[model samples]
Target: MTGNGRRGRRILAAAVVAAALAGVLSGCGGPDDVSTATGSTQPAATQPSATAPVAANPEGTNAPLPEGAAVAPSPTGEPAPEQCSNPTASLRPFPDGAPESPALDRIRARGRLVVGLDTGSNLFSFRDPITGSIEGFDADIAREVARDLLGDPNLAEFRILSSADRIPALQDRLVDVVVNTVTVNCERREQVDFSTVYFEAQQRILVAQGSGIHGVADLAGRRVCTVAGSTSLTHLQRAEPDAIVLTVPSWSDCLVVLQQGQVDAVSSDDSLLAGLASQDPYLQIVGDSLSPEPYGIGINKYDPDLVRLVNASLERMRQDGTWSRIYDRWLGILGPSPGPPVPHYQD
Candidate 1:
């Protein structure tokens, strides 16, 4: 071969090699590029991804707020029931063993206790992905009630309810009772009867690690998220009037927005915030509790007899160590069992 031909061939081969290297570098993105492309550095095994397929909320977008959730709070519109010195004080339970009542008769006839609760409430009552069954602290509590009434812990039928639907479900007799984390107070007492306080929760803040938010005081002018129709929202609004409060339909939705950077932080009961934190190690619960929330089982107002029966069942759970067992199974993350809340009788 001629010298000129060899020199031209060498230059062309060198140019080709340089072009291929450029393409390879572009295909293998840098660390910043990977972070921006994925929108987060959180481990996929630990946290949900926006593009990942979720069994619930298939679209992967934040769940929509329930109807009327964005509107201003409305009055209950009926004559408020007489105020009680202790709203958590409930009817005295009947003696355990063969407890009978008219409401119990109706429920026994139905054969399955219809319990209302939100499945998206992690640690409280959420769908277990592996078993495809709803299981949590609150779910176990409902099962206990079913065991007492129907003699089989698995005989209860769970009805999914939004936070706002809790009172209406009881009033309309759609469910035998609500085992969701409902706060017992005077306003709800007028609408539905309550069992003794089951779990005591405290409102607090959840934020990404290194977030400037240390407490409610740091929330002013910052975007905060919580479930609509929740006492958490009311307390947050009262605590920081200037905060840009974002209300969603579920606590999971609050976690989604916070992860997506649509909100600065999430505020809710520490029990709930802990659940969110468990799903994402990047998140943390901060600050002292804002308020004490006494959770109770909600029943229809006319079913005073049923209330007595439920209170009786709760007492049995407390004495027999079932409450402690269930709490440890689901809520040991919150530290040692505090034991069950002491029952108070108005009678």
Candidate 2:
């Protein structure tokens, strides 16, 4: 064929191909018409509608607790009265004034009182998002101590401590005192001196709503979450020896596990559990007191004078109704206070 004839045929073929693609894009009924001009053989997948629920993996969260998790040691039995005061006992203020305490003198020399506590405790010592200050019932009590010691509530340096660090911090003198909701027990007294009972907490369990696990009785054979170095783990082990215990670094970690369904429930002091529940409405505290937890300010064993000063401050708080006011500020949701725990002075 001539060159012009060949060129004419090529143009005609190109026109025919363009026509075919138009037919496909226009949805003209034909065998190949189901395809689009872009050459896709199927409809473009539609994005999920705005109101459609997205699927999620409930287990797609932090890993589950490992096997052979650490358990808290059994509490050491009562100590000799001469070594430590009764956990329930506290001293009264001197008739004239707090006697000049060497520990108090050192704290005054430093200008800032150092306190150790968990910053994650919601109602007790968590940070306030708005004011950016760690404020709660425990924080208030610590501030009261600071005020009593240094004449200023703001002159306090809060050092965040893990459950495991409470005693070690005191022993190493890393902190002047620990105002974390430390429970005074026979075993703990051997390592550190504690103030008279400033607050009393009962052990309890927290579970997601409708979890079917109502209390410790239902915890057998199930996974329960608690913090490492916490008395709750020890109590749980004794109460349900067969239950699978999961230990986390913090109480907040236990809440995360329970919310993610990695554990059946989180067990700890009612006050701490209440703080967790306040964060998530779907979570609820169940069960009753597993045991009584008497909270005290932990100080170095060598600093009996500091312990006495803390006890005296607590006494003043109770006398002036400061304890009740602080309680109503953060923990009133739990109900009215039963009145400040009475001081029992061993001396």
Candidate 3:
């Protein structure tokens, strides 16, 4: 049993490293780099997507393969032969269009909700072995949005994107909404509209087990890892200004780098930091959350109606206890509800 366990860990470790390497190769290798295109399921959006569609398994016509068979056991213990999967389905056709939101009507008339999302974030939208799905908390949120707008969550098509592309995705009409973990900022507002804040996050530091380093001050000259498309990249650069940051496409990969001593620490949102910490007890989240990361849904600047409708839906979810249920389902450990919404904004 011990020997098998050790083998499993080794395989898992190699898989993780490959994932990290793939993130880098994708950008530098281009078409020749098939790993990032194939290895990492969670694409980097530093902020990113709603639930995306899956091939076959559409409407469950052909029953999904047994979950066990779907995943081949990896030397790492993760069953494989099973490719990673997208969290949800494409947006279903709403040919009739939503009369409630004029912007949605326009979008529907054009066909497809071009959703911009992070292709490489873990636990939020990373690859899954059993079902080859891009399953995660972030993807779940996107799934719900696609369900609401497309009348069928399966109708919305997701486009992998990065943090820098959040606003640009909407501005360019490449996407109808950016379900990425986009923080609401003054500058961001200049380019696009935002839904009421959905998640309240902050930057926290993550260090490997037994590492003498405790906080940002220790990071002055040490190497750190942050997701490639995140402001965290810039944040680390500005804070240390001299610290080495080995940026990867996803936080999961960041953890691998830390485990391998490739980087000293990984800094990102508090929830994410907490999530990463939970994945491995050795890694710890330290220091107070330094930056407020109030996440909002992104929409085109030309689409106020869509934003309003989404806000109304969000409010409905809150009022109906749906939001709380989801929270308990996924984030009960975060703490109890703070109270009713603070009422962030209106059209």
Q: List TM-score per model, in order.
A: 0.77, 0.76, 0.68
| Model 1: number of backbone collisions | 0
**lDDT tens digits by residue: candidate 2, 1-347:** 56456445444543433332222112111111111111122221222222222212125553533222232322233332343435556445454545677877888888988888876678998766666577789989989988988889888777767687789888988789899999988788778888888888999999999989887878755667887778987788667554566565567768776777766888899999999998899999898789899998899999877877787788899999999999998998788888888777777
Better of 1 and 2 by TM-score: 1
Where is model 3 poorest over a 10-residue stretch in terms of lDDT? 64-73
In candidate 1, stretches whose alpha carbon ends up further than 4 angstroms from where it belongs are 1-84, 96-100
Candidates 1 and 2 compared by lDDT, better number:
1
Error of 3 at 250 (Å): 2.5
Q: Give the TM-score of candidate 1.
A: 0.77
Per-candidate alpha-carbon RMSD to the true structure: 18.0, 23.8, 15.1
Q: What C-alpha lDDT values do all the predictions have? A: 0.75, 0.72, 0.58
Per-residue lDDT of model 3, residues 1-347, tens digit only: 36656455545644543343332322321111111212344433222112111112212243321111111112222322332232111122233434556777776776656666654555455556665555566666666676676667556566666555567668977777887777766656667877777777778789977787777767644556776556666555544443445555456667665665656788898777776777787888887655677777788887766876666666666677766666665565557755334445431
Candidate 2 Cα RMSD (Å): 23.8
Q: What's the CA error at residue 56 for candidate 2, in Å?
A: 15
Off by over 4 Å in 2: 1-86
Give the per-residue Cα lDDT of candidate 2 at 78: 33
> Candidate 1 residues 1-347, lDDT tens each?
56456445444543433232222112211111111001122311222222222121212354433222222222223443576688899998887554567788889998988898876689998877666677899999999999988899888788777686688878988888999999998888888999999999999999999999999988765667787678887778667654656556678878886887656899999999999999999999999898899999999999988998889889999999999999999999999999999988889
